[model samples]
Target: MIAFASFAQPPQDAIFPRHHPDVVDDMDVDLGEDDFERGYQRLTCPGEPITSSQAFMRGHGTYVDNEEVIASVAGTIERVNKLVTVRAVRSRYNPEVGDLVVGRITEVQPRRWKVDANSRQDAVLMLSSVNLPGGVQRRKLESDELQMRTFFEDGDLLVAEVQAFFADGAMSLHTRSLRYGKLRNGQLVTVPPALIRRLKSHFISLPCGVDLILGLNGYIWVSKHMSQSQQEGDAFDGEAVYSNRNDEIDGATRIAISRVSNIIRVFGAHFIPLTDTLLLEAYEWAVEQEGDVRDLLQEDVGDALVATVTAHN
Candidate 1:
């Protein structure tokens, strides 16, 4: 499992001189060894020299400069074999094949819907990619094309997988399975895409009667949990899968959803990588506080939550 640990900043006193009486004392301190030497590595600044051309091949976020590989973005240096790359601490999501993402429909074209997935270019959701409201294997006729908005219209949010890419590098998305469709009974939360670590399953159901969809593009969906029997009765029932309306939500479930959303917001503010374990721990801690869910957003409370959760991590 990937750890959602936060990197704490180094002490200011360690970086600057406190007593200036002795020049030898300052000179004797080895300033070259920083947090990078320790377990927590330092971030590489833009244009910082990373390695020699003969030693490592240039990768993403790096450029060749005078036979030396330099960082093109401020991020952490990642080395894979002889290739060196820099992963920006915060960047737009880069879609990979089979990556599950939640996106909002920006425009409805002739046979495709333009989606915003927090990338440089909008992703394309083709009409043929979705299962029509009649049956799983139903053919999409020209009449179906005229009523395409009935399935997904402008400003609708849906979860899908990266199917392919255009020549210009824009991603093409698909939603053919029951698991990939319109999102309802939920609220969306935005965070840094980097905070959401890759997991075996992005769909998470908490015991508190809330369900979570961790999108690779940092679009999180927190909603009421539904049982298999409630949702998986008949594949022929397209309304169950494609309906834009949300199921009836109770007061308890609503509170649980808000609580979980707030917990995610707190984690994002601390720049902590998000994982199932970390979210559960933070939720429990927040509940123990015996305060309103909104209280977690307070500066002092957020700090305490980060410190406690990171300590446990």
Candidate 2:
């Protein structure tokens, strides 16, 4: 057995030097004045103390603890008056009053239909809220309840606005206006809800003969182009508005619709915000490609398309 020599230990002061508490805290939490001025800056995280509770009140996505305003979710900080809120970068749809949404009927109940609007709970669409086929002022009879499926059945998609809320916090939707009704002559495309920015008009008509409905819930409807006048004209034809039948879509219109849908898919993939001008620019560039609608899905083509659109934006 080999014998080991004993050595004196170094002084604790020299071996482990003490650091100032302020220095350590400063090193742990970096708060710079320039952090706020940066464009679209999101420099916050969950459980991170933002400021003293006495100075700022906690708001959504944040909580108060030990006289400190701390975030409850990872997101950027927002300030309104004395209230501080952290808006999560990615979250489920939080419906607000009068917000338009596109949803699919999940269940057909006695007088209300359960709709999936990408929310935590299924939304409620009552029979009384919908415009009957015969006319807008038509009364709902027990016979109407029997034929509720005729107006809205399971798996049928429609667009409507958030009218009210149920006792349990579920959304109540309404389709009293002609603009809100059964969806046809188009296909649904879903994206991250954050990408669908609030615009003056969610109903967009592309010059390529396609109509796009940008739902706040991120469900986009791409269909054959229709003018507002045409939409108004069809409002009287309740059969057409509520009809499950799709209007005749010509071959050219079909290709245009497919191309527009593909462009949107590409934009969503790249995490780009959808806007009327951006879409118009993208569509114009896509048409210039002289390629088939399916070509946009190719890796090189998709990347190039995104690059082109983003460059212009």
- Which number leads on lDDT? 2
Per-residue lDDT over 137-238 for candidate 1, one digit per residue giving the tens place of the 0 to 100 score: 766789988988988889999999999999999999998876778888999999989988788999998888888999998999998998766655533586
Candidate 2 residue pairs in backbone clash: none
- Predicted structure 2: lDDT: 0.84
lDDT of each: 0.83, 0.84
Off by over 4 Å in 1: 1-42
Clashes of each: 0, 0
lDDT string for model 2 (1-313, tens) is: 5763222233579987788766753423333444445646555788788777887778999888888878888988877667778899888888989888999999998889999999879999999999877456867889989989888889999999999997888999999987888999998998878889887888888888999999999889999998898887787876777788888999999999898888888877777889988888888988898999999877678888877877875
TM-score of each: 0.86, 0.86
